[model samples]
Target: MKWEHALKDYKLYLKIERGLSNNSITSYGLDVEKLIGYLEDKHISVSPLNISKETIQQYIYELAKTVNVRTQSRMISGLRSFFNYLIFEDYRVDNPLELIESPKIGRKLPDTLSLDDINRLIAAIDLSKAEGERNRAMLETLYSCGLRVSELTNLKISDLFFDEGFIKVTGKGDKQRFVPIVQSTQKYITCYKNEVRNHLSIQKGHEDTLFLNRRGKQLTRAMIFTIIKQLAVKINLDKTISPHTFRHSFATHLLENGADLRTIQLMLGHESITTTEIYVHVDKSHLKSVLQTFHPRK
Candidate 1:
């Protein structure tokens, strides 16, 4: 089969079978596309079904020179998953990446913001501007609910369950979870909706969307990143941060405050408890306190 045809089928399997998000599918597709590009550049005619391990190794060798170890490792993983899909479909006998070893990279802990830092960042928003209240609400929701940026953007007006003190969030792979919402956050969101969002001439499909741009369209992921970056600059924050920083902070802060891993895992909508364990590493002091309080030796 042609590379393009194989790629199209692979993407369909990712969406329908694996239930990956669009961004995830696109990322996986890009890995295969990069291999295709490499073959074309070298004038090597090889289809996905018949591509040899040597060709893939050569591609990896070339790729390692351009990307960092982490990126190279991720690309290899993506390609491996694609080939595994082919095997699952009975299109291939074995994956070309079966013997390929990924680089050994240390687990990089996520960066977290201190409560004071978070407060300063939020305080820096220009409240006089029309988007100020919206920005405040967005940041509060991000931290309070431990939401992914995409979840925040795709949040709908109907998702708010203030009477029950939870907001329904659609996480990765479209998995839905109800996260508890603090009354303060609820108030901010309500104020923004009643004041600013109500005033917006919302576009046709975006009326249900929680956050909208000045044009009344759904806010893009890039826009959320831009908003956080701008706020960091306004506060003169030294560390580089993104919207995910708030999530990391949310998890870390909860762990520090004696919240259990299982509880935090549920709140963050993590599919694996292992994913939530990273926060334990984020706050060693919390662990020390726990040991001091509970250990018989203490």
Candidate 2:
């Protein structure tokens, strides 16, 4: 089959069978597209069904020279999944990337903000502007609920269950979960809703969306990043951070405050307890306190 045809089918498999998000399917598709580009550049005519391992290895060798190990590793994984899909469809006998090994990179721990740092960042918001209250509410919900940026952007007014103190979040793969919301966060969100959002000439589709831009539509993910980055600059903070940083801080702070892994896992909507265990490594002081409090020698 042609490379384009194979890629289209692969993306469909990712969406329908694997239930990956659109962003995830796009990323996976790009991996195959990169290979197609490489073959075209070299004048090598090989289809996805018949591409040899040597060709893929050569592509990786060239790729390693241009990208870091982590990026290279991710691309390799994406390509591997594509080939595996071909095998599942009975189009291929084996994956070209089967024997390829990813580089041995150490686990990169997530960066977290201290409570004081968080406070300073929030305090730096220009409350005179209408968006200031919205920004404050967004950040509070991010930390309080440990939501992914997409979840925050896609959040709807109907998702807020303030009477039960929880907000329904739609996470990766369109999975939904109920995460508890603190009263303070609820109050901030309510204020933004009753004041700023209520005044917006909201677009028809985004009327249920919790956060709206000045254009009265759902806020984009980039806008959220820009808001946090601008706040970091206003505070003169040194760390490079993104919206995900607030999520890391949320998990780390909970662990430090004696919340167990299982509970944090549920709150974060992690499919695996192993994914939540990373926070255990984030706070060494918490580990030390655990040992000191429970160890027989102590």
Candidate 3:
């Protein structure tokens, strides 16, 4: 099969069968595309199924020269998953990546903002521009709901169950969950909707979208990042923060305030409790507080 055809089918499989997000499918496809480009550059003609393991190893070697160790490890992992999918679909008899190894990288800790820092960031918004109202609401929703940037961009007006105090979030793999929205956050979002969004000329297919650009189109993930970066600079915060940092801080603060990890996991749309458990490490002092408050001997 042609490279394009293979990629298309693989993308469909990832979306429909594996239930991966669009961003994840694109990342997996890019890994395969890198291989195709390398073969073309070397004047070697080989299909995905026909490429030798040595070719992949050489590609990794070349990538190692330019990219950092973490990127090399991710590239290797992405390629490994692609080859495994081919084996699963019976397109290949065996997986060549089985013998290959990924480079070792240290586990990275999630960055979190303090409540004061978060307030400072939000306070920095100009609020003079029309989009400022929407940006404030977006950042509030992100931190309050612990939403991934993708989830924030795709959030719908219809998803808000204000009377019920919850918003329905469609997470990775189209998994749906109800996250509780605080009254304060609800007020900000409603203000944005009534004051800002109501006046915009929303585009077709985006009428239901909660956040919109000046063009009235749904906001992109990059736009969300850009907004956060600009806010960080305005506040002169030292931490290299991103939209995901708000999410981590949401979980971290919840844990620090004695909220249950399982509950936090559900709200964050984590598939496993273990993923939420990592927030516990952010504040070890919380453990001492828990023991002192709850222990019968104390």
Candidate 4:
């Protein structure tokens, strides 16, 4: 089959069967497109069904030269999954990447902000601008609940349950979870909603959206990143930060302040404790504090 046709089918399977997010499907599709480009570059006429393992390995070898070891590992994994999909569909006898080994890469720790850093960022918002309150609310929600950028942008007014002190979060793959919302976060969101969002001429489809741009539509992930970057610049902070940094800070701070990993995992909507365990490597002092406070021998 043609590379284009195979990729289309694979994307469909990922969305429908695997329930991957659009961003994830696009990422996996990009890996397949890269292989197709390599084939075209060399004037190789092999189709996805007929591609050899050696040719796949050659593509991977070339990819390694362009990307870092961690990115190369991820590329290898995405390509492998695409071929495995072909096998699952009975279109191929075996995956071309079956024998290909990914590069060994160490786990990189996530960057997090200290409480003082967060305060400085929040304080730097220019309250004179109409978007200032909205930005403050957005950042507070992100840090308070450890929300993914998409989750923060897609947050709906209907999701807020202040009476119960929880906000319903729709996470990756549309998985829903109830995360407890502190009164402070609730106050900020409510202030923005009442004082700012309520004054906007909201677009029809975005009526339920909690955060909107000046155009009255939902915010984009890139816009959220831009807002944070501008704030970092305003404060002259010296660390590369993103919307995810607030999330990492949320988890790390929770772990540091005596919250257990399982609780953080649930609050962060992590499907497994293993994914949440990365915070343990962020600060050894937290571990020492836990041992001292809880261990009977102490």
What's the TM-score of each model vs. the native? 0.98, 0.98, 0.95, 0.97
Write one digit per residue (lDDT tens) for candidate 2, span 70-90.
999999999999999999999
**Cα RMSD for predicted model 4:** 1.1
Per-prediction backbone clash count: 0, 0, 0, 0
Runs in model 2 lying further than 4 Å from the true structure: none
Clashing pairs in 1: none
Cα deviation of 164, candidate 1, in Å = 0.4
lDDT value, candidate 4, whole model: 0.94
RMSD of each: 0.9, 1.0, 1.7, 1.1
Q: Name the weakest run of 10 consecutive residues (lDDT summed) in model 4.
A: 56-65
Across 1-298, the per-residue lDDT of candidate 4 in tens digits comes to 8999999999999999999889899999998898889999999999989999989888888888899999899989999999999999999999988888899989899998999999999999988988999999999999999999999999999999999999999998889999999999999999999999999999999999999999999999999999999999999999999999999999999888889999999999899999999999997899888889899999
Between candidates 2 and 3, which one is better according to TM-score? 2
Off by over 4 Å in 1: none
Ranking by TM-score: 1, 2, 4, 3
Candidate achieving the largest TM-score: 1
Task: Give per-residue CA lDDT, model 3, range 122-231, as digits (tens).
Answer: 99999999988999999999999999999999999999999999999999888999999999999999999999999999999999999999899999999999999999
Could you tell me the TM-score of candidate 3? 0.95
What overall lDDT goes with each candidate model? 0.94, 0.94, 0.90, 0.94
lDDT of 1 by residue, 1-298 (tens): 9999999999999999989899889999999899999999999998889999999999999999999999999999999999998999999999999999999898889999999999999999998988999999999999999999999999999999999999999999999999999999999999999999999999999989999999999999999999999989988899999999999999999888889999999999999999999888889999899999999999
